[model samples]
Target: MKKNQNFRFEKKNRTKLKIKIFSLQIMEFVTHCENSESSTTSSIIPEMETSSQIVELALSVERADTAALLGADESNIDTLEKKRLEEIRQQQISQAKLMAERRQKKAAMGMEERQNWEQEIERYRIENEEVEERQRRLDIDETMEEFYPKLCEWVGLSNYEVLYNSLEDGTNASDLNKKICGEKNVMFIIITKTGYAFGCFCHKKIPYPKKSYIYSMYDKKYFTFSLRNPSCSEPIYFKQKHKGKSICIWPNDEKNFIFTTKRFIKIKNPNGPHGTRSFFHGKFSLKYKSKDHQKREHTFFTQTTAFDVHRLVVLHWF
Candidate 1:
């Protein structure tokens, strides 16, 4: 009976050992399952974060495109608005012009307004004529604009008409007499080859010349001036002293034709090829250079006693 009891005790201990081992194996299996679940959750969390980031980038790009589209729409709208305003402005101008044309046509068709229309036409014609005349005068003045003011000051007149130009008209004594004789308030401008410009103004009418070597007259309102002189910086002027035969005319002699003033100056053979010899004395003379044959020093209004005439102009001062 004791042997039987020992065998049963051994069997019970073996069974208890086997149960403990089985329990340990179950705990290890549960630990392994937990580790695998944790690894899967970690990997899935990273993938979820990456996916969320990608979605956010896509949303940002969409927002940018939307903003860009909105900006483009606003720009297009502004451009259309400007074009519409410009078109409206042009239409308004056209309408205004059409209305004016209609009004003008209506006013011109009425019979009672015929006289008024005719008067308006006459006024317009007069205005046009005045404008043309003003332009013509301006053109003429521009020809002598350089020294016109000085000439006007010397003649004591603001208005004048060029009557004769030797370059334009024939350089003859008969040509000068035709335009100048019997004309009052006449002026003479003489340009010399040696760079001297001088002139004289006569208040009395130039008389017709007689059949003689020299014809002369007297006038108190006669004066002489040197516009340009090599020796003088400013213009030189001289008034008549005794007023004795201040105007001399030559009618027949073309080559020897000249103008002279008694006790003042004598321009000999003004149109001659040998040039002219002027003797300035008393009130009309000044210390000047000479261009004579002997090169004699002379007291005159010019640098040279003998000078070739470049241009001769006669003007009627008004």
Candidate 2:
């Protein structure tokens, strides 16, 4: 019984030791397996991370290419816009040049027109002056023809005889009357001392009531006379000296006479009816008396009643 009990105790002790050993081996094996698995997972994680990075780099490259293409398109658009703007500027410059040329042409045309108008006006002015001159000459010729016959009838003589006698005697009478009647122009007249036996000629008309005088005569006297045509007078008488010795008195018309004497004398009635008469007094005298036994005082008388007593006295020494 005692041997059996000791043997049972030993067997129980062995069984416990075996159990502990087996547990320890199982733990070690589990630990070793866990470590191996952990290392392998770490390596696999690194490979996966590297693959993801490669994918990311590829995506970045694609995005970069797309951006470059877009930038190229933008640059092209900017170039096109610049070209268009330059074209517009060129068009504007062309239009400005066209306008400048047009204005210059218009100004040149206006200057040409103004010059033509001035030339036309000058031509018209010269034409008008020539026409006026022609008309004046025609009128003068017509007037001379109409009055020539009337002057001859009024003077009670033929035209040829009046012209011939005037030239021969150096007289201005026929010429003066012709001028007054518009037959000729009368410049001046030669008158005797008595205002009669005078001569005149002219190519123009003379104003009426013309009178003139001679200064010194053969009788030492000044003689003045006047020729006048009154409104109601028929027979004209020639009047003589105011206060002097007179000789060879000749009657010109009513209130007109001439005297030959040795000295100049002033007339009392110097003015005429029309205030158009002229009086001329000469500077020298004529000697007409005999030497010894010559009568120094003599008076000549006219039968005509139309003479003015105060202004027409003729005195001479015989």
Candidate 3:
């Protein structure tokens, strides 16, 4: 009996110690459940509000990104328009330079053509002048050959020497005078045996008888005469009177006589002694005889009386 009671008491003490350790583990599990339920109930409304705020911030960020993309597209369109305008201005400048260069080339070609035409004209003028000079020289030589010989023959020159000698002497001069006098009909022809020639008259054949007169007054005597043609109606005569008993007389021919009275004169023919009567210068004068008057006065006093007068009259008519 005693051994059985000791074994039972020891078993009961071990069972009570295990039962206390299990009760402590159960109390720790119940405290953890109550703290988890309190934490979940307190944070439920605050969590919902924070989630709604985050969704609104995300939508605002998306709208800002879309506006930045649209601004970049507008800037690219403006830059493309400026580049196109610059390209059009550069093309217009290039075309203007090309037209200016072409105009300069055309003007230079026109000036060269005008200079060539002037040179051709000058060359033609020089050639024409040379041809004219040659033709002029030929004409002068032909004219000299055709006319020179005929001119010499017409002047009656067999040679130049005969013409020169005849001109130097006076023989041709006298012949020329005879030809001129014959042509004018002023020369009196004398048909001699050798040839025809001329004659002159004696002074007694003159009709103005007063040429042989002498004048006397107060013991002084004077003689007078004149030169004229007797056949002409206008005869020139000179007269004078003497104081002494000297008589005035004149010759009518080689053997004839004329005597003066105061108012009348008597003319005797050469063949007879009988005289004819004529009036004087209205004065009564007497006639006397003188043999010396026949030899000295009648032969030498006459000139070639009518030759110069005929020449002057013919020239006046011509």
Estimate, for each residue in 124-193, the C-alpha lDDT of model 1 and write its tens digit.
9999998774444333244257577877887789888889877778666777778888898998877665
Comparing candidate 2 with candidate 3, which one achieves the higher lDDT? Answer: 2
Q: Model 2, stretches more than 4 Å misplaced? A: 1-66, 76-79, 136-318
The lDDT per prediction is: 0.65, 0.36, 0.32
TM for every model, in the order presented, reads 0.46, 0.26, 0.22
Candidate 1: global Cα-lDDT?
0.65
Model 1 clash number? 1
Say which prediction, candidate 1 or candidate 3, comes out ahead on lDDT.
1
Best by lDDT: 1
Residue pairs with clashing backbones, model 1 = 289-303
Put down candidate 3 lDDT per residue, 1-318, tens digits, no spaces. Answer: 998888888866754543344344435546655767554422332232355543543454456667788888887887887788778777777877877777777777777777777777777777777655434322322322433254233322322211111122222222222222212111111111111111211111112233354322222222222222222212122233333322233432323332222222222222335432222232222322223343122221232211111100000000
Which scores higher on TM-score, 1 or 2? 1
Model 1, which residues run further than 4 Å from truth? 1-143, 213-216, 263-300
- lDDT over C-alpha atoms for residue 202 of model 2: 26
Q: In candidate 3, how many Å is residue 91 off?
A: 2.2
Tens-digit lDDT string for candidate 2 (164-243): 22223322332223323322222122222222212122222222333443222222122221222122222222223333
What is the alpha-carbon lDDT of model 2 when measured against the actual structure? Answer: 0.36
